[model samples]
Target: MEVKVPKEIRDYQESIFFGLSTRQFICSLLAVGVAVGLYFGLRPLIGSEEVGWMCILGAAPFAACGFFKYHGMTAEQAAWAWFKSEFLYPKKLVFKSDSLYFDAMKDAIAEGEKPPRKRKNHKPQPPTGKER
Candidate 1:
């Protein structure tokens, strides 16, 4: 069955999906690059010693944290769950559109009330003592 979406809902969904997907893609790429760079940089220090295993183990958590933070998920799975429920759900479209419209209207009103631009202060300065 085909589903119908209101214009506002459709617009909001498009905007949010594009924004979040772009952000997630960029952040995931960055996290991967950082993790790779960190591994290469730390490898010299780690070497083939017994401490190398410890270093590798320590780096794993750091990489995981970086990945989570890049995705705006944080270290807390509960918080991420809450975020998906409260902010990212499809049903939140109504509230998002209302908020987006309210903000745009407020900005339009503010712009309308602004004063017109005035000319810059360009009056000539009086002659200095040195010139006199």
Candidate 2:
């Protein structure tokens, strides 16, 4: 008998039960538990139809968490990274460059070589009392 293996070793996941990885199995179990709990807990307060919807909604996140993987990161890791990038340590990068040569040569430029201009000084005139 030939054993099937993933083409990429990194993509391989050991199946714990029913062809599900340990993480998937755990998350699926949790999702089912949540759905059942929500259905029972909300059934008395809300109608069966609404309770069924609520159970699905409540269980979706748990199921998604187990299946989600990106760039080798799990759902929580991706979420944390997103949170950090969006809020915790967001960066607004401004590229500013200073030239040492330009600074050093500024005083030696043609404009800098010109002599400073003298300012005209005039005494202020007294205002006429009749002027409105």
Candidate 3:
């Protein structure tokens, strides 16, 4: 018998039921519960067809949480990161470097003194007749 193995050991998740991990199974159960609740609660007020659509919409987020993964982060982690980036820290961070050389030369530059041109230390000279 050939046993399946994941390329990355960390990616391996033991299937608890119906080929779903424990977390996935739990989320699926929660989604089903929400869908059933929505269907029964809304069916009386709205028609069966409308309530069915509402159940799907209501349960989708719960189901997505189990399946969704981004950049190795779970849905909840990604959601929290997004919330922090958008609400808690919304300002754009720009990097500004402080150059001591530039700061020292600013006065001369403003006074219109052109910086000295860089020169190569080693210049090619005519080859000597003597060979090594």
Candidate 4:
């Protein structure tokens, strides 16, 4: 069966996808630039030494972190994954995906809604559980 997204979901998905992709691209570029800078900056410190190994070792982690942080994962997914991987194993993937999907749904709904009233307790709470 074919799955179709509602207009609001489609809009929110498109917006979020574009926003996330842009941020990931920029962050990846910045990470690479920082790595390059480290290589060059270390040249003076290491006295033109073949510190290629140092650069690789040090920058690799940063690059990995940046990739995992911004590119390979979404903000919600990453946070959930981190929580699961760090504290809860075996059920990590299951929980994270469910939570992320729920969050995405809520974001789509919120994006489609009219502006909230300017009154106390009017602020929308972030999505929680599976309500989205």
Show how many residue pairs clash in every candidate, following the order shown.
0, 0, 0, 0
lDDT of 2 by residue, 1-132 (tens): 999888998899989999999999999999999999998899889899999999999999999999999999999999999999999999999987598866766776646675456989898989989898
Candidate 3 residue-wise lDDT at 63: 95
Ranking by TM-score: 3, 2, 4, 1
**Each candidate's TM vs. the true structure?**
0.28, 0.70, 0.77, 0.33
Candidate-wise lDDT, in order? 0.58, 0.91, 0.93, 0.63
Model 3 lDDT-worst window of ten: 114-123
CA shift at 105, candidate 4, in angstroms? 48
Expressed as tens digits, the lDDT of each residue in 1-132 for candidate 4 is 998778765334332344555545555666677768878888878754466776666666545553464545656678888788788885434433557656757866677865345776678887888884
> Which regions of candidate 2 deviate over 4 angstroms?
97-132
Candidate 3 lDDT (Cα, 0 to 1):
0.93
lDDT-sorted candidate list, best first: 3, 2, 4, 1
For candidate 4, the TM-score is 0.33
lDDT of 1 by residue, 1-132 (tens): 998778766334233344554444455556556556656667777655534555556556545553365343455675677788888984634533557656757866677765346889999998787972
Query: Alpha carbon lDDT of residue 65, candidate 3?
Result: 94
Worst 10 residues of 4 by lDDT: 10-19
Which pairs clash in model 2? Answer: none
Judged by lDDT against the true structure, how good is candidate 1? 0.58
lDDT value, residue 31 of candidate 1: 59
